[model samples]
Target: MNTINTYRKKRFWAAILVVQILLFFIFSKLSIAISMFERFFEIQKEIHQLLFSWIPFSFGDMLYLLLGIYILYSIITFFKKKTRNASLFKILILVNIFYFSYQIFWGMLYFQKPIVEKLPEKEITLEKKKELALKYLEKCKQTRAVVMEDKYGVFQISDVHKIKTEILSQQAKLPSFISSKKAAEINSLKPSLFDGVMSFTGILGYYNPFTSEAQYNTQLPSSYIPFTLAHESSHQLGFAREQEANFIGYLTGIQSSNPELKYSAEYFTLKSLLNSIVYEDEKFVENVISDFSSGMKRDWAYEKQFAAKHQGFLNAFFSFTNNLFLKSNQQEGSVTYSYFIDLLIRYEN
Candidate 1:
């Protein structure tokens, strides 16, 4: 009877897993459902941030740690004959709960109308990208001149507190025509407990859907930190597509009064535009790099060195997995910058 009951429960959850896949796929196409989820997310995130924001350390990180241990233990139990059936039941139940919670809390937002639909569309040209790249390059050089720097002369963010405040205030400044989502003023950005591991994994930061927290790697180059926070915070603001989040983050940063953040935002924009143009004319890309201001050059070199140091199986593996995850969520995969460049070029025009 016990074995029979275990099999029954396992089968039920397995069925639930399949149903959830179909349900999310179906709901992803309905504008009405997407609108409802968008509203629900704003309220749910507000509540969750209110509950979890007080703790200085990341509760989401701890939750992930515990969840990882549980998964490992379940796998171990699968190998033992006495516990195999029970373990299968538990695994199925866990998977069902996780998938349902993920879809409800964060996944459905992926189906929201693409931000591009809200903007004026124009034909993007390589010349337009190159022109914008030069414009941003000059913009970054000017912004970098005023920001604080370390003894090494690399750009340093003296206070993350100021950047967070600026990001919140800038949220309202986002063009109403593009994004109308409500922005909550909670400081839920956190330095991840897994920063060391994240450094080698090619991940700068990530949003914790379960806890309504934004987690950034503390070990990143100073220039990357402020923009990374803006990007992850975009996720908290209900923008799910990676490139859309980047666009939104760029909007927030470029509007900021804080120079640290403005410089970071401008630098990222310069890089993104250059990335889109690199394949068409390699010499043009090199000339632009050569033209970077001395200070900007130092920062760029450190970023390259950091990327080189982390090159190994770990980075490659994570890059592949992240690409797969993005595509699974209906994004243009991790390797492409064209979506963001398309948005940028059209917006600029």
Candidate 2:
């Protein structure tokens, strides 16, 4: 009878897993209803903010740490236990709960109307990209001249707290046509405790959907940090897709009165534009890089060094995994920045 009862429990959990998988397919078919998840998003933000905003450190990171330990412990115990079926049943149940929670909290946002759908459709030309690249080049040079530099002549943010404040303030000013979500003043941004891992993996920053927190790799070059913060905060504002977050981050940073923020955004814009056009017109890309101000050149060199130091098999593996993850969620992978370039062209035009 005990053996029969154990088998029944295993069957029950397995059925729950099947139901959860079915729900994913069902949700994937309902883009219209899934878009409505933004309404629930506001409530979720409020609850998460109330619970996590006052915490000094990343509450979300703490949760992740605990979850990791629990998963490892479960795997170890499963190998040691005689009742392998029961252990499998427990694991299945845990996975079901996690998948369901993820969908309710964040996964559904992937089905929202694509940003490309909101823009006027037109073929963007190579000339237009080149023009924008040159335009941002001038902007970067001009902005780079005014921002503070360290003793090493590299860009350095004077006040991170002020930058965070500026980011929050700009959220209210985002173009209403693109985003209508109310800008909440919850201060849950935190530097990642996993900075070493992040640097090696090429992950600039990430948003914690469960805690409504934005985590950035503080160890990055100053030029990358500000824009990364804005990008992650874009996710906090319900932009699940990476390129959408990039576009929104551009809007937030470009409009800032803060010179550091402006310079960072302009530099990233110039780099991204040049990267997109480099294959088509290597000469033009070379000229653009040559035009970078002395300070911007130093920052670029530092970024290249950082990337070189971290380049290896682990980086390749992470890129592959991230690409698969993005594709699974209906997004272009890390290898393509064209979606962001596409959005920039439409908005700029």
Candidate 3:
């Protein structure tokens, strides 16, 4: 009993120290490091793209290997003659500290933010903004893209049999090292209470855009879930640039036969265009609103509801992160979401 008590106290303090060091690194050294590499971050991003593409191994496999080693260590400790409950307590605390600390460090350093340039207010007339939205939608429709799905409650596509692997292979190919199990894990996720949830660490989802497998909170509303899933899943596949991921996710979701997923993609794409036109042309905005389908109108209403319900924390944190990404990457309003500008430009050309 005394040994167990002694072990527990030591483990607790050690965990506390681990957390302290993690915070210090994030709040101090990380800021300095980011400041120093503010100019080189793009290069780093490019390097990451190359690495994920060429490495041929997924972080999922690496995690499995790591966990296996940890289990081995635990087993060895279990069999050791002098092993005690105290040692087990110490190991558990240490593991927890390391997991959360790594999460904090990754969130601070690599999460992509939207662009922070001042958005033009009262620039585009409502008519013009609507027009541009319709134009984009027309093009999207012409592409045979099945816009993202609705919110509220609906069925999602999770079966591999329902999707074409060739199309997936073409859209955003995964590393071979990505185990079938991990791929299934991604595919098996249903529209539960956990989709699209905002994390306490300011992570909108799991893909830090610079690290291992990406994950989203799963508790988000239905309309946003497919897009968010596609967004972060793009990151997992190693597309680090937010614009690229957004564009890819949009295209991929549209190609999917799932109704809910399709609407989600189209909605966000239209929303992006709407937000973009808010600073540009008026006739474009007018044209879009006039032509939208009734289904779209209903979807927009639900979207507004979802936005009203949870937009406070998620929106504000995204704003802060966007500003950080722009300042760090030498771009102008948080350019994180501004990737849409490039997408619009590319699609237009």
| Top lDDT hit | 1
**lDDT of model number 1:** 0.92
- TM for candidate 3 is 0.49
The residue-by-residue lDDT of candidate 3 on 29-114, one tens digit each, is: 45565444433443444454455534433443355457678878877886775775655665666566665545343433343332
Q: Where does model 2 exceed 4 Å of error? A: 81-83
Q: Model 1, residue 279: what's the lDDT?
A: 90
Quote the positional error of residue 160 for candidate 3 in Å: 11
Q: Higher lDDT: candidate 2 or 3?
A: 2
Q: Which candidate number has the best TM-score?
A: 1
Off by over 4 Å in 1: none
For residues 1-349, what per-residue lDDT tens digits would candidate 1 score against the true structure? 9878888888888988998899989998999998899998988999999999999999999999999999999999999999999888888888888998899999999988898988888988888888899999999999999988888899988999889888988987889888899886889999999999999999999999999999999999999999999999899999999999999999999878899999999999999988888999989999999999999999999999999998888899999999999998889989799999988877887
| Candidate 2, run of 10 with poorest lDDT | 80-89
**Each model's lDDT:** 0.92, 0.87, 0.52
Candidate with more favorable, higher lDDT: 1 or 3: 1
lDDT of 2 by residue, 1-349 (tens): 9789888988888898898889777977886668667788889988998999899888899999999998887888788767566677778888888888888889889888888888887678899999999899888988999988899999888998888889889999998888887877977779998888888888888898889989999999999988998888889989999988989889999989999888888888888888899899999999889888899899999899889998887788889999999999999998788999999999897
Off by over 4 Å in 3: 1-132, 139-204, 208-211, 257-260, 282-287, 313-318, 329-337
Ranked by lDDT, top first: 1, 2, 3
